[model samples]
Structure formats: C-alpha cells, structure tokens
Target: MGFTAMGLAQNSISGVIKNENNEVLSNVEVLVSDAAIQTKSNENGLFELKNLPIGKITLIFKKENFEIKSEEIAIGKQEQKIMVVVLEEEAHHIDEILVSSIFNKTQNENVVKIDHINLKNIQNEGAINLSDAIATNPGVNVVSTGVSIGKPVIRGLSGNRVLTYTQGIRLENQQFGEEHGLGLNANGQESVEIIKGPASLLYGSDAMGGVLFFNPEKYAANNQTEFSVNQVVNSNTQGSNSSVTLKTSEDKFKFLVQNNYTTHADYQTPNGETVVNTRFIEKDFKVGTSYATSRYVADFRYNYNDLNLGLPEEDIEDARFRTPLYPSQKIENHLLSFNQKVFFKNSKLEATAGYVFNNRKELEAADEVALFMKLKTFNYNVRYYLPDFGKFETIIGFQGMNQENRNFGEERLIPNAKISDIGFFGTSQYKMEKSLLQFGVRYDFRIVNIHEFGEIGTEGSFQKLDKNFESINASVGFKTEITEKITSRINIATGFRAPNLSELSSNGVHEGSNRYEIGNPNLKNEQNFQVDLNVDYNAEHFDFFANGFYNSINNYIFIAPNGNTIDDNFVYDYLQNNAALFGGETGIHLHLHEIDWLHMTSSYEMVIGKLDNKMNLPLIPANQWKNNFRANFNVSKNIKNSFVFLQANYTFNQNNVSEFETKTGNYLLLSSGIGTDIELKKSNFNVYLTATNLLNKEYIAHLSRLKADGIYNMGRNIVLGVNFKL
Candidate 1:
C-alpha cells in the first residue's frame, strides 16, 4: 500500500524514552494513532516502528504511573534517527484520545464537543447495566419500561432518531418500538463516547438526535496471553452477572473471546413490594480478531445476544428468581462485522461491512405467540482520507444499508417491508494556531416499500404502499481559545429522519397503549436544525464547563386522540407539527491542589420541548442536579490505585407536561463505593462494593413509562463485584 510496502524504499522511525532522573524506562508502549502501528520499548528504552508511510504522523507513548505523551513527527524517504522523550509522574487522570472522532483528536482539540467515559468509572458509580451507565452523563436520560428495559433518550429525542454503533457498525434491533431496549451488553466494552447533538452529516438518516459509540476492549500485549473474569451481585433484584474473556496476541495477530450471562428477579421498591413480571435474563457471547502491518490493518468481530424479558402489568408479587411467565418477550440478536484499512504514502482508505439478524417474539400464553418477526440488515461503508493540504484535512465517504422485515405470527404490528438507504458525504477540518474549523455536507435518500397485509378493506387489514424520502444536511463548527486557560466552541447543524414503518403503515388495535392506532402513508420526513455552544475554563486546580443548545424541528410526528372509539379503545391518529427544544448543562471540577488526595465534581442539566401551539412534548426528562466528592489513597507499592467516593443526585419537580401526562415531584438519592487493586506475578485482582438508591427513596421518575401506573424506580440496592486477570 505504501512505497516501502511495494519494495521501492524502506521507511522507519525509532525512539528512546527516559524518566526525569535520566534513567532508562522499559515496557513503555509506543504507538502511532493513525497508522495502527505500535511497539514496546526494550530493556534499553529503545523502540522502533518500520515500514511507516512518508508524511506527518502522531505518536503516543504510555505506561502505568507516568504521564501520557503525544508527539508529532515527520517521516522522510529514508530511515529516521532515534528520537528522545522524557516522562513525568502522573498527577491526575488527563485527556486521552477519542476513538469515535473522525480525526482522532482529543476532546480539547475537536471542534464539536463530545462526552467520553470509561466503563470502569461507570461501574464504580453503582451502575449495574449499560443503560444505567449511560444515563450518568449530562444531558442524557432513559425511558424505562422497568429496571431491566430502558431506552436512551438524548436531548429529548428517542426511538429511531438516535443511532447506536458498536464495532464500527450500526445496531438495529426493532428499536422503533417504545418497549424495545438498547439490545446491548456492557461485558467486553472498554468505554463509550456520546455525540450529544445532531450527527447526520457524519452518519446517515437516523442520527437526528445523536450517536452512541461503544469501543471494545483491547487485546493482550504483544507476545502475551491473558485471561480475565468478572462477577457482580446485586441485592434488591437478587441478580447476578458474570463474564470471562480470554485473549492472545502475537506480533501482528490478535484474537479474543468473551462470554457473559446475567439474570435478575423482579425489582423491589422501598415498601418491599416487587414489580411483578419485571424479571429478565441475558446471554451474550462475543469474538474478535485482528491482523495489522505497518501499511495495512484488518479486524473482525461477532456478537450473539439472547434475552428473555417479562412484561409488567397491574400486578405485584414477592421478589424471586424464576423463568418468565406469560406475556413475556424473547429476543435474539446477531451481529458480524469486518473492516480493513490501507495506508499509502500520503493517504488512507478504509472499508467496512456488517450484517445483523434480529428475531423478536412476544408470547401471550404458554402455547400462544401473539407476535413474531424477523429483521435482517446489511450495512456497508467506504471512506478515503486525503493527505493533508497544508493545515487542512478532508475525508470523503459513502454509506448505505439494506434491510427487510417479515412476520411469522398471526398478529402483525406492521406490514412486511423492505428499507434501503444511501448517503454520500464529505467533511473537512482546518487547523490554525489557536483555533480549528470544521464543516461538512451530506445527501441521503431512503426508500420504504411496504407489502400488503391481511385483507385490503377490512378492519384488521393494511394496504400496500411505497414511499421515497431524500434530504440534504450540513454542519459547521469552530473552536478557539479565548485565553491561555479558557476555550469556547460553537456548532450549527441540520439533520433529518425518515418516518419508520410504525408511523407510515399502522392500522390495528394497539393493546399496550389501549388505543386503536392509525397510520398516515402521506407522512413526510422529520427534519431539524440545531445550534450548540460550549465554554470551558481550566485553571491549576479547578475546571468549569457550560454547554447549551437550541433545536427546532419541522414535521415532528406524534399521535393524538380523535374522539372516537373502537371496541372500547380510543382512536388515535398520527400527526405532525413544528416543535422546538432547548437545554443546557453546566459543571465544575475542583482538584484541590492543596490536597492531592481529594477532588469534587458537580453538574446541572435540563431540557424542555414544546410544539408551535405551546403544548409541551411528552416524555421530557425533568431537571437534574448531580454532585460527587472523591478521595484517593495509596495502600502499598504492590497494592495501589485505591479510591472512595460519595455522590448525591437530585431531580427537581416537573410541573410542565403535556395534557395527557402527570406531574412528578422532586426526589434525591445517594450512592457510594470503594475499590482497590492488588498486583501479582502476571496477575491482578480488584474488588469493589457499591450502593444505589442508598436511602431507599420511593419516587417515580418523570420519564418512566411506568409512571402512569404509579410504579417507583428501583430502591436501595447494594452491589459487590470483582475483576481478576492473569
């Protein structure tokens, strides 16, 4: 792929590392971010990466107990001489490279502000699942059917408007249904990155709300084999989660396998009454492999998920672990993806493909299946990153997907349909001394073909239909430093989403909602324009950030009653109108420079949505205020990285609501945990104990779908977990 790869020349780079005392450092990890090339320093503090492309590239050096170093270097036609670098002891956790960013820039350097968090940090905060972990971030919430089933709501938007990506591919699992969950497990993932605003210019259609990207765990170090296991126990629900991962890596090849199992009984409230039929079980298995050279890289991953979930109605029972009763759901999901990258002397090209299979079944009785369907999707993406033009960088890409849905049960929620999507986009970034500018344009076309269902003119029948939708979207952003420690960023973006089948072809009795639903085949696409602003101040021991956004949407889709009834069910119609939402988040972090062992953090976030007629939108999250205080201490040289924290979360009363919604009062909850690590010969062991809803608060959340039934969220639950590796 490169000149050196073609045998026309040989290009190489070497480096040496040392400590402040001028002593040699061994086992230091040296990496080239863009090229996917890495090597470890030998006993002599020397590392070399050969067959590199001839151009400017970034190098990263990392090791435990030392500050990370990022260096920019240029490689010429010939072999490079050794470069020397010095490392200092780490004072605190600092910035790390963002994997989901198109340019691989850190948070401080990117024009668009992104939120990133590690899974370990989330676990320590008393999060028992993926949904709970994501909701800990600012400006993000979840719409929960129960403790086991939660859907992410980003900036007041849920359903198909938000996109989920894992292993560099989209995740599709009938997410348009209100009762559908995220269909993801947190077993093998390393961290998560969230784009809080519109991302349609980078992703295709369904990204009007935002993007959730999960980064998988890394393989073992070169020429090493590792095995890791984790076990978690939850008190209130009597749940247990267990996982094991094994990995082996050679110089250029790596392989990994992971297995996870989770099971929970009904969750209990403060009064000790369990929410009946809230139990669930999940079995997840994942495999991954990769091969890389200086000029090329290839990776593959596959995951299979099986879930058995029970649906709660007007019932209460004692907590117990058992198989789900009637009115339960069984979901099976499969995902496989492969990607490869080629690096030339001055440019790079990447191609990726993925396939997903989803089978969902709703059982009404032991022998009766009320609904069953299968959805298959195929996705592809190709991109070319042009060499730098002075200080400008550019990328052109094509993305598309083909999907189909089929029903196998007697009842069909929507007609069998085929969906296709195609989009082309180009984005660019320009760098200046103290500022960066980014802008992009994207064009997308989507087609939905619905087949006939049942009888044509009957009450329980649907008609055949075909629709096409297309839109052009664009985004622009700028980041600049106003002072040595103060920075500001502004981004404006336009996004769009094609109507899903449920909105375009529904003509049936929806039992879950107790309404006779009707669909409008003439519905248009939902489009929106949003503007975001962020400011940050970083001092020696204190840092503050404020983020705000305003979003306006045209042709917003919703359902409403029309003063009619079918078999005691209210008749509702699908409708559209203009709507707007605005919100912001502000937070501060104080490191307590005088006392290196202590640090504090706090934040406030809120969002409000209203239609053009001034009617409030449904399912909006109430205002929230969160605070945490943490302290770290050292045990012994062999047993380090110990920490403890206490946190308080308060939700303000939500009086503003739609006509059909009820108001929710304010509530506060406490959480805390402590963990430490012990090192052994080629092994490590860490343990932690955490508690959520520490005070056993009995209050319902404003955004919970179960709020109408007066069901409270999970109460005081304690968790114990351990991680061991060898």
Candidate 2:
C-alpha cells in the first residue's frame, strides 16, 4: 500500500489505473519517462513510484488493448500526491469497442480525419447544447431554427446525409425532419468523436456526409462510490440547468445513474427584441449497468428524454415564459441497448442490440393536436475479430435495422412507411515500423414501403409505394511518418445514402420549415466520392496541422423553389443533380516554453459547395477564422488549475448564394472566461464565469434559419456554473 523509498527527503506519486469503462485495470505498466522508476499495478489497480525528483515530471501509462496515456505533474519538496488516471480503450485493438474508424488506431495513426472534443472544455465554454459544444471544432457548423433547436452540419452536408450514434447504436429519432435537433443531452456524456468525411465503410447508409459518435460516461472504479451535483444559469434566456449523477462499483458489477432538467424562457435578440415561442423545457434520465469476467462481458443501458419545444417563426410582443404557446412540439424518446462480448485467447466476438421509440406531436391550438407521429426502430450489429497473424489484423461485421413510422393526428405530412436495411463489411489493417495501412469495403441494401390511406387518387390520399436500393462502398487509407517531426495521412473513400421517406413520399405543406413540399418517388440513392489529406508537425514548443478534402456527389437531392406558393407559403419540390464540395482547415498551437504558463492558438476554415451548373448550394457556412490567447497561473493550496482566456472569431461575408437565397454580411465576436477548481475539506468544487459576445454585436449568421425573418442572433450574455463533488 506504500512506495519503497530509495533515498531520504524524496517525493512520491501513487495512483490507480482504470479503463474507459471505469473498470479497474491490473497489470498496467506505469513509468517515468527517461527515468529508471517503473512499476506495474497490482490486482487492485494501484501503483506507487517513490524517491522521485521534486519538480515537474511526466507519467506514462501503458496496457494491452488500450491507448497509451501520459500526464504531467508538479511535485513539491517532500510532497506525497495521490492521482487518478484513466486510459481510453483502443478502438482498433480492444475486444469490444465503439469508434468511428474501422481499424483500432490512435489519432496520429488513423488515416481518416477525426476530431475529439473534451466535454470539460465544452462546459467551460458555456455551451447550451451538444451542437453548440461541437461547433468549436474546425470544419463543423450548426444549423438552427432557434436557440433550442440546432443540428450539426459537417462540411456542407446535413439532415439525412449525416449519421449520429450513441451507446453503440444508430440514433433513429425522426432525423429526416429539417428542424429536428440531435435529441441528446450534454450531461452524462464523457466525450465526442467526429468523423468529418464519408464513413460508410464502418457505418452503413446515411453516413454519406459524416458521423457524430457520442461516448457515454464510464462507471466508477472498483470498490469506489462517487456523486456530483451541477447547476448552470444563463442570462440571455433566463435559463437554468441542474443535473445529478451517482456511480458505484463492486467486485464485478458497476452501475451509474443520472438525471437532468432544463428550462429556458424566450431568447432575446441583440436588438432587445424577444422572439416569442422560443422557450423550451427538457428532462433527461439515464441508467447503465455492466458485469465483466475473464471470458465474457455484458452491458445494458437505458435513456429517457421528454422535451417541450416551441416553434417561433415571427416575433411576438409577450415572450418571457418557460411554457410553449400555440404551434409547439412535444417529443418523447426512449432508448434501450444491450451488448455482449465473448473473449477468446486472441480473438473476440461482440454483439449489440438496440431499440428506440420516438413520439412527436405538434399542437397548433390549445387542446388540439395537428400533427402526431410515432417512430419505432430496432437495430442490431455483430462483429468478429480474427487472431492476428504477423502484423495483420482483420475484422468482419454485419449490421441491420428495421423501422416503422405511423401517424395518429388530424394531419399528416408524410405517409405511414416501413423501412428495412442490412449491410456487411470487412476491414483489415497492417502495421509497420513507421507506417500503417488500412482498407475496408461494405455492401448495403435498403427497402422502403408506404401504406395506402384514404382514397388512391385524392389530394389527401396516397397510393402504395415500394422502393429498393443497393450500394457498394469502399475505402483505403495510409498513415506514414515522413520524418521525426512530421506525419502525413491520405484517405480515399466512397459513401451512399438512400432517399428518405420525406423525400420520396411527402405531398403537403410542412409547417416546421414553412414550405409547401412535394416528393419525387423515383429518386435514387445519393453517392459520393471523397479524398482527404492531413499533415502534422510536432516540436518542443509548437504544433501545426493541415487538413484538406475534395468530395464529388452524384444524384444529390435538394428542395428547389418553383416560383409558386400555396396558402402564402413558398412551394418547393425535391430534385436531383450532380454536386461537389472542397474545403480545408489549418491550425497552429504555440507553447510559450520560456514562460511555461502562456499559450497562443489560431485556426482557419473555408469550404465551397456548388452544383455542376456553377450554382452555389444553399445554407453553406461562411469562411471563418478564430484566435485565442490563454494564460495559466499558479495558485494557493485552496485553489487549483486557475486560468483565463480571450478569444476572437471573425466570419467573412458570404456572397455565394443560390438562386433563391440572399447574401449575408460579415461580423466579428469576442468572448472570454475565467475559472478555477477549489478544494474545501473533503469535497471539491469547480466554478466558472463566462461572457459571450462581449461587444454586444448585432449580427445574423448565414446558416441561421431565422436570417430570412430578419432576426439577429443572441447578444451579449453572462453564464455562471458550479459543480460540487461529494
């Protein structure tokens, strides 16, 4: 239970190692870089290193089937510190893993471009939703109807083209709707990994654009119990959010539970105008349990979410409540999943099954429901890993899903439909001394069937429709270290997406987007081919990275206006054409080694999307540049990790417009924040104060759906948050 001393008046470090699942990991190797002090964790996942220099030092943790983790610490004279270290499971090397990539490899080794967002950093930014949190990443954007409704857009693609996965299952919460958010809460989530390009080789259809993978929080360590309470308050909308989480683990069983509630009033514009029907309320609950043994492991999770969201298309005089008025939506979602893994000597078999139910109702008047839809989805996946032979490792997998959509309200925008999908894929990786190569291929088949209702040839009736689609997708990539300080990766991949129900069957006015829409039953699957290149350089004081991509799509589907209107709403119809997109992102990080507590970072991103006729795509984000300066300071014993940061974001004028879209002007915004961790008795607290839009600028984002309505985005706002751990 103690470190063996090698000298007098020496410092010591003791810690425990746990895997991403929060399970205690034994036999983990802990080492001091460039030092002779090294030890392995015991059966209880505890290790100690004694007689260490009383200065700055770095510790490295390594284990089989897990990514190597490194942490830096500062030790005082004759100081004894206890630490807790967490190791992420290697996506490509672990027996059972959930990742966006096909092969288990670190970010530096993966050929495909990927980005990771730490939730702690997002929380510090005072993000209101998951989309807002992820928007900080380069090459990612968000499309929003209002503050309460936002969806992630990768490059220039969104909606059905992008896929979202949680708990190792594809989320099926009626994503085909234009105004639907991701339907996920930010609490109880550990981190997010974004694949910024086509990823159909691992995930099947609907990944023609990219993928957003959310990893759930891990359980507590063995024989450990922990609880936390968090609260956040926002000024712009007079909003408040509170959450509580409890986790405990025994010898072989681990459990976790979390509950969160959020309520917000109508958001105020920079011009001091209140946009009515912008208020919302949400409740989320999550529970998970896992049991593990040497040869078998089982895990189960369940999540429930209820939301009351308002749809604001026009400005109203009185808007300051938390309840939705007329023209609002009540949505309820439930997700349940179970996963099993069988571990062999050198290979593993993993199976996962999930079910999701989504109920959505749109109320146009008090006690009257105008639109209601129920969606049910069942999905399953199985993957088998073959024993590694030499330097080659292979995995084969199969995935399938069945979905049904039904309506029970007075009006229906889309017909009742049933959809089925099945796909098979195989991927392999070869590792060399300084290079890694990966390749994968997949085949997918989908079927859609629409039921007939009312009369066959009436405006309010629909005829029976059946459609089938089949596609073959493939990908190949390579990662190589060009020199001791530079690395490069190149990837070429193909993706496809089947036409969604709204695109193939819609025949009426949609109130959500305020458009009269028609569908094309003969639409084909959209296909895309993309090539990506990434280069990076890492030195002692500086790090730099550049990413570029070119994508070409065939049979691209879009809704185009036909110069007509129905009941004062613009009329649009689904159409197909050839399109292309090209973009790149570059960034640099400079570490002030001499000062050791100062840093500077900057990045720029640009993208362009157009059809074959040279017409620009609608709703594309404008080019942007971001810069940040941060300073870290040493504090007293009661305070830890104190820091302050200043940031500036500039968006260029978006002159590129489609035939029916208007141009948007440019704007700049400034933000700053300060935070610190406090220790009191046996408990700890994290407190932060953040200010956004410090200049109180009035501007409209080019991608905002409210831009056409002449409504500005949120203005200056202050946020205060605190977390107490017990």
Candidate 3:
C-alpha cells in the first residue's frame, strides 16, 4: 500500500517545457529527484520535469556540445506554469578563444574563419556602425571617403577583392561605384562578421577583400517580441530611432514581423558648422515553418527596403542647384527567398534560392534632372553532407543578374547590361577524436554583355565595350587543435571580380562622393591572392582570438588617374588602375562570473595597407584603439528583476595619417550608459540612459568626408531609450 502511494506521488508533479521560440519539444529525457531535476531538450527543444516538492528546486539542461544551462526556481503552487528556456550557442574551437563574429566566442563547423565585433561592448564605447566597431581589430581599416560611407579594407583590399552578404546571400550594390555605402541598414543589426582574406570557395567574386556578413534581430534566438524607442538630442544633431518586433510560435509554425525607422536632421560639427542633413526609413518582416513528418525543416523569408539619399556633407551648400550635379540618390529593394533542409541517418541536405529587385533614382533640385537605374538578381545554392569517409560536404550554385540605366537628357542616355555567372564548390571535414581538419575549393565562370549608347562628343564616344571574361578561382584551408584550449587555422585562396555595369558605363558625378567618377569601358577583370592565419584560446570564463591576413592583387582596378578632364571646375580624372594591397586584424575578450552580479569585456583592432610599391594606401585607416568597461548589479528579488549595468568606452584616434591624402590628427571620444531590466507578471520592461561624447571632444575623424571643410565630429549627445517584451 505504501509503494502504491509513492507511485501516485511520482505521477502528480509534471509540467510542460518549451524552447525559446515557444515550440514544444519532444523525446526529451527528464529525471527528477528530491532536490534537483535534469533533462535533455527534445527534438522540438521541449521538455518536462515531474513529481517535485513544492519548495526551492534546481534545474539543469544539457545537450551534446551545447553550454550547460542551470537555474533555480521556487515551486510554491500545486500546478506550475510552463517554463520557456533559451540555450545559447557555445564556442567549440577553444574554451579561452575570443572570436570576433560571436559576441561570446561560440564556434560553428561551417565557419572556417571569423571576424566579429560585439555590439554590447561597442555600444557603450561611443562606437557607431559595423565598420567603426571593427576599427579596433588589428588588420582592419575603414577605407572611407567620409563618415557617411565606410568600406572594410582587409589586408589592403576591398571592393572587388571582397564580398559582402546580407543574411546569407550576395548583396548587389553599386559597391564598385565608390559612392555607395554598405547599402544595408546597420543601426538595427545584431552583429557583423568579416572573413578576412579569401572566402571565394564559399562566396564568389567581390569577395577579394573578404566578406561582410550581417543578421538582423530575427536571427537572435531569444528575440521574441521586442519594442524599443531611442532619441538622441545633442548640440550638433537631433535624431530618433525606434524598432518593434512581434514573434510567436505554435508547434511547428513561427513568424516575425518587425519595423524600424530612423531620422536625423542636419548634423553640425563641434565647430558649430552644419555638416550634412540626412534621413531614411526601413521595415522588414519574415515567417518560417518546421514540419516533423519526414524529418525535414524548411524556412522562407521576404524583406523590403526603401531608402532616400540626401545631399552629401560636401554638397549641402548647393543642395538645391546641385541636385543633378550632386549625388542625391534613392534606392528601393525587394527580396524573396527560401531554404529547406532534409535530415538523413547520419547527414543532411540543404537547398536555397532567392530573387532580388533593386531600383535606383538620381535627381537634381536645380533644373529638374533625373536618372533611373534598375538591377534584378537571382541565386541558387545547394549543399549535401555525408558521413563515414571523413564526412564530406559539397556545394554548387549559380547567379544571374540583369541591369538597366537610363538618363533623362536633351536626346537620350541608356546603358543596359547583363551578367551570367556559375560556380561549383566542395569541402571535406575529417574528424578524429579531438582532432579536426577541413579543406575546400571553388571554381567560377562569368560573362558580361554591354549595349551601345547614343553617339557622343569628342570627349568620349558613347560606344560600348562588349567582351566575355573567364577565370579559375580556388581555395583550401585547414584547422587543428594545438591543445585543449588552443586552436590554429590557415587558408590560402584565389579570387576575382568582373566589372559591373556601373564600373563599365557610369560617366557622371557620384552623388555620395560629391566628385566626378568616370567609368572605363576597357577595364579588365581584377584578381587576388589571399592568405589567412588565426589562433583561438578559451578558458573557464574567458576567451581570446586573433587573425592575420595577407592579400596581393593583380589588375587591381582602382580609380586610376585619367589624365583627362571633365565638366569645368573639377580636375583629376579617375578611371580604373591596377594596384596591390596587404594587412591583418586581431582581438581579445575576458568574462567573469565570480563576482556573481558584475561582468566586463575589453577589445581592440588595427589595420594598415599599401599600393603597388608597398607605399601607404591612400585612404587606409590610421592605427586606432578602443577600450570598454562595464558592471551589472541586482536590484530586486521579488520579480526577478535587476539593475542591469553601467558601461563606459574610450577610443583613441588614428595618428598615422595617410601620406597619399591629408590625415586628421589623433583624438579621444568617450561614452557611458546605464540600463535596467524589470520583470512583470507576463512581460519584461527595459530602460536605459546613454550619454555619447561625454567629454564633448571637438575632433574630426580621419574618415569623415567633411574633414576637408574643417567640420568636426558631432558634439556631446544624450540618448534615452526603452524596450518592452511580451
């Protein structure tokens, strides 16, 4: 009779468990004891613990290589509510390793290399944008015309030598146009990854400088329903930024709807001078589904962006009349894509396809001038994984793009182009106990077509240059563990970049650069030789990682000295010229839990490059450094809330001015912020106070476009924001 009573008690205490996405997990192993309960997350990441005392209890969650998660909860009621848990990805390469891509140095097998900047650390340090955050990394530099636009220059290469992907697909921007910024919205991004050197084995052309990758809020595991609003009011500029997202899940269905808007009036320098008046808007939405019928998972996404460009800081003086002369441009983009995965006995297969449409318009306020351009792109990629013989992986993909540019003039200006490209890529990973080795290679083929424009003046015939360019690209890499806490990786690769429509036909002033940019019809394709070496270290609670890179270019098509002239006032003709480049980047991090309620992280980056003769690269960033300090403390116990933290950052400006161009003197910028998390019955409230440029430093950034005008960076700024989760 007593044994029967014990059995009834064991069946009395059980509750449901769900993953962070709210999906019910199945097949999870749950073990309950007198004081603690242990369980394994199910296929859907759900679990349940039954038959427990109504008092304080401890829970532990674990999986193969995932970080062990533990928490204490009070069981005061008979029927406990369902609990939702989040499992963060952990760095597997090294315990003490501090990789740049993952905020806390989590590792992934698909990634052979990574370059990352933690937003939390940089947010407190007065850093803005993905480029500025990465500036502290060793071999990285921002080849910027001004603050409005910044491009990553790794090992002295960018543009065609590098590749940039938004989400996971190629981003088609007039990046080769010189005036174009990264094109994607940066303010709301979670983190950015830069794969220095060659990534051609995975990403195709324009990846010579490496790859700039980003994931929006939806990419974060714990990003469910969040709402945030921020305002920055200062002596130099007035701005506001806000974003809201709604996410929900039921069994195997999930969706995320998000919207973000930012607007900043004209910003002035500390010198009390107006630099530039700019503003923009962006909105994104996505939905995903997972079906367990046939051991398959599928996801589909669609996003849209509408951006309006205003006059550049250098062109604001003539904003009205220079509308046509200046680079005031507008761009609208729409994208649709889908990815599916099929899990087999010991392997998996993945397939992905996407389509993108982009439209560009340029207008001048002076005489009713307008220009229109459109680009359409399509892409497809597939990968298959197999076990047994060292676990092999292979990938194949193809991309096709068509573009058209039309200019409104007295007669007619039309430039149309088409591009077709295909590539085959393969990689193999060998695993032996604690040892791992990986190698990959890719081949690319591309062709271009150009149609003639109306006959033009003696300055230059509007004739088109039609030709087919072909090249072979390849890459191989290997990674190994020197010790339990140390890992090393090395890679050597080849890359290529074919001239895009803008590079081959554009013959006007680039609105963003506020300068005349001429295109070369006879420009040949550019090629690159790239190499990388990296080391990762991990400890119980701390991590550190470093990356080194070297890149050499042949037929490096840069803005060459045309020796000719255009219009009347501007001189110095710019066409495509061959150049060489090289450089590297490194970073570190330290985390502590001994203090219980306090934590801190610190990091830095440096980059340098040169042209053909190893001379100083014209726009290469000067040596730079950044440091951050932060602390968190608990404030309440009833609602499980905490007085989050206070953080401060100091940045050392570059002293190594470019010899090719005048360099700005070194300067210092500081910032501080405080945040709090409040727990509610069913939601969470977060609030923060941030002060930027605390010292009110009156200094100009070397990368600022207004440097020539003696315009300083923005003066002290204060921002107040709030976030709500439900």
Q: Highest TM-score, which number?
A: 1
Off by over 4 Å in 3: 1-111, 116-156, 186-190, 219-236, 279-293, 313-327, 391-414, 456-461, 569-580, 591-604, 638-660
How well does model 1 score by local distance difference test? 0.86
C-alpha RMSD between model 1 and the true structure: 3.0
Model 2, 1-726: lDDT tens digits are 112223235467787888767788886877653232456788889887665444445566777546677665655556677777888854322112225566544476566768877677687877888898888888888998778888898998888888999987999998888767989989988778899889998889999999999878777655568799999999998999999999886645779999999998888888898878888899999999977643556789999999899888654445447888778899999999898876555666889899999999999877899989999999999999787879888999999999999999988877899999999999989989999899999999999999988766554465689999999999999989999889999999999999998888777788777888888899999999999999988776687989999999999998899999878988899999999999989998887567657778889999999999899988788999988887766488778778899989999999998877789999999999999889897789999999888888999988888888888988888889999987
Using lDDT as the yardstick, the better of models 2 and 3 is 2
Using lDDT as the measure, name the better of candidate 1 and candidate 2.
1
Stretches of model 2 off by over 4 angstroms after superposition: 1-45, 48-98, 315-320, 456-460
Better of 1 and 3 by lDDT: 1
Candidate 2's displacement at residue 605, Å, is 0.6
Candidate 3 minimal-lDDT segment of 10 residues? 1-10
- Ranked by TM-score, the better of candidates 1 and 2 is 1
Residue pairs of candidate 2 with colliding backbone atoms: 92-104
